[model samples]
Target: MGRIVALDFGMKRTGMAHTDEMQLIASGLTTVATPELIPFLVDYLKTETVDVLVVGEPKQMDNSASESEELIQAFLKKLKAACPDLNVARQDERFTSKLAVQSMVASGMKKKKRQDKALVDEISAVLILQAYLDRKPFI
Candidate 1:
């Protein structure tokens, strides 16, 4: 089976993660500046076959859509148009960022690294992908 990819899309940077071909583990891939994402993905896809694209869906605590929803919707539309055959899915990402930060602190990362937004984004992507995988069997 082809690998799966996850995206944590943000205004300034986009975090990426991918599963192994066996679809077992989700690993943080990289963080790219927002402006570089499309070209980067387009090039990466040329050399890699991805079966699914999981995008983080930000939502409010009460389950209302967050402000990022609109941007995510636009990105999803463009993603579908770019890769019509790939399955695109969304997973709620309410606490991924906070979880990422906590994880970094627990890991004893330096203050600078712990505060790195890009690193947090990448970790959040991994968390998002893991959440999606956990739900797949039920779906």
Candidate 2:
């Protein structure tokens, strides 16, 4: 099976995560600058067999769209234009940053390391991928 990639996109930085070829578990990938994101994915896809691209869809606590949805939608448009044949999916991303921080604390990560926003973004991407995996039906 091909890998499944997830993206936690932000204004300046974007977090990335992907499952292994077996697609069994999700792992933190990397954080890239927003401007370079599309090119990076395009190059990565040339080398990797990615089956799906899951993007974090920000939502408010009341299930309304988040303030940054427009940004994401713009990004998605660029992504789709770049990889027209690519399969893309969206997963609701709520409280992922908070959960990532709690997880780091539970794992005994030092405050200095946990405070790294890039790391948090990466972890949040992993969480987003994991949540998508949990809801996917087994074949």
Candidate 1 off by > 4 Å? none
Report the alpha-carbon TM-score of model 1 versus the true structure. Answer: 0.94
Q: What TM-score does each of the candidates earn?
A: 0.94, 0.98
For candidate 2, write residues 1-139 as lDDT tens digits: 8999999999999999999998989999999999999999999999999999999999988999999999999999999999998999999889999999999999999999999999999999999999999998889
For lDDT, the strongest prediction is 2
Instruction: Encode model 1's per-residue lDDT on 37-94: one tens digit a residue.
Output: 8778888889988888898999998999999999888877887787777788889999
Best by TM-score: 2
TM-score of 2: 0.98
Q: 70, model 1: CA deviation in Å?
A: 0.5
Residue 131 displacement in candidate 2 (angstroms) = 0.2
What Cα-based lDDT does every candidate model obtain?
0.90, 0.95
